[model samples]
Target: MDIAALQRWLQHAMTIEARTSKGIIRFQHGSDYRRFLLRLKQNASSNTLKSVKPIPLIRGISCQLPAGLSLEAFQGQVWLEKDCKISVRPSPYKAKTMDNGIPWGVQHIRAPQAWGTTTGYRVKVGVIDTGIDFQHPDLQHSLLRGINLIHRGRPPRDDNGHGTHIAGTIAAANGMHGMIGVAPRALIAPVKAFDHNGSAFVSDIILGIEWCVRNKMDIINMSFGMRNRSKALLSAVINAYNAGVIIVASAGNDGKRRTVDYPARYPQTISVGATNRLRRIAPFSNRGAYIDIYAPGDKIMSAWLKGHYNEMSGTSMATSHVSGAIALLLSLNPGLPPAEIKAVLKRSMQPLRSNKARRTIGELDVWRMLQAAEKR
Candidate 1:
């Protein structure tokens, strides 16, 4: 059917349904719908029907439609907005007393053993999250100049503390006075895509991925997730992967048995799930065949805002461990591709003690991973 014919049919069907359903269907044949149709026609006339206007970073536009409108009628013609959230626990614990040594997560993953071989020197990790605390002593030397997508003129500094925590997990470096990270020598480039509230649109994330690719980042650490899939986000991820950048993402905190979140669900990313100190899966971690590996994420202490430390838990923490582990691998062999790195990671994992039935997903062993890389 032609576009106009389809629209008329949808309207008629919606109106009929609204009348028969006795208020169950509230079809608003108002300016919103009119504007949407008008934009649709404008896009079609310009031969850019699939692309959303004004926002070049996003490939699709989202709008509310009448309840009875058939989605199949506009198949392949409409794109909806997908909301993304930082994958973190609901509550974060403030560290009352400070400890001066390697964090438990860093030690749990056996990162100290690999430190003798490579401390991930010269590796660049692009963190696309809220932002980072540039003044934090543990992160000051480990941070590189980064961008702020939320405020173009300002620096990408942490406002929500999520990015700072993620950064500390991957690359915090304070030898004597504070805690060290998994890849203490690695540099992190903060890409502020989310706001202070830790909420982000898929477009901002896509833009962040573009920046990482342009900056030639060795690893992209994505500690956020969304339930719905965005084609534009997936495309950006594939492009980054093909550009020889390894992307590590959280498997999500939904605690679902068989479902993972995107872009973690996307095959190009190395999906990580949460594991506690006991080497068992965390209760909040999403698990399935898509989880590439597990890492320590339960009550793990890391850098917070204002040069302090705190304990947080979620698959986001798990993802940072994997990203840091990859940084160590890349420091040894910078030429290794994403596929080979993923293979080495998978082959070097240790079996989880709690969930043995699903042997497909295993816990990360950083020392073993580096050893495996040497053999390759």
Candidate 2:
């Protein structure tokens, strides 16, 4: 079935379940599960319910139905399933020249000033993106064992340069050869949810989040978004937030003033917009009251594929900065919950010089944030 049509059907099916079911139907192992599957197959009047896979993380199921089929007729058959549309890709970014020493973004956020207190030692950040260049020298020591959801039982290696770039910005080592990141000593667990083309299913992302939480990651960096909201995705985000895992997401590159992207649009996420070295919001950044903070994203330098370095500009890069900053905070106060960490981040923000009216959204000041954390 075409993705768009499948998405519509899933949305309608979920709505019907929400209106009629007593609560979310939780599946169990053994005979009950087998019986449920058997019943599902038996109820497939048109044989459209090809597969009904369970996603235990969100306590939902992914139903595969035929395209253009009206879900209204089968509402009673799949009342327990809350399926959603799939596929969201990483934001578009620009490539620029390479640089040495601390990247301008790292300096702009004042991450160096916080290093004296904590270099995010041992803090684990879960990066849900294309994956990482595990062989990159700068990122070699900074990486921990991570999963490749796209390919089971394989390393989460980067084929596309996006995830490696994001990882480099978050925790590339402070070695002699390359640029350092915001939290140079922090550990990253690369979760390969998106593929080489940067596209990923919503179900894959939900699975990535479940992996991060179960593995006890201190933070999650989601540098992607979908314009339409997914109830299933939101449920996963909420579960991660309640598990004390801070999630930082990109506002998007739509260049709109009114709204940002889903996952980031969710209240549980620390939504981020892109800013340039001029301390002004990047023209490509999606800005709105929903954006929690801004960070250096324009022409930011970091690691790429093949142990090389490249510069990329997007809210994705900006989100990495925030994630690294959170690592610094968590390294200092390991017990701080997601809400309090977000509060400290907001409390230490510096007002942007470009837009006076946008008092609600400001640039991230890692040094200031760490100082505030120290006092608390």
Steric collisions counted per model: 1, 0
Residues 219-265 of candidate 2 have per-residue lDDT tens digits of: 99999888877776888899999999999999998899989988999
| C-alpha positional error of residue 105 in candidate 2 after TM-score superposition, expressed in Å | 0.2
Model 2 compared with the native: what TM-score? 0.84
| Candidate 1 C-alpha lDDT tens digits along 68-116 | 3445555445433333333333455375345757888889889999888
Clashing pairs in 2: none
Worst 10-residue lDDT window for candidate 1 reads: 19-28
Q: Number of the top candidate by TM-score?
A: 2
lDDT of each: 0.79, 0.80
Taking every candidate in turn, the Cα RMSD to the unseen true structure, in Å, is 7.3, 6.7
Model 2 per-residue lDDT at 130: 89
Clashing pairs in 1: 132-158
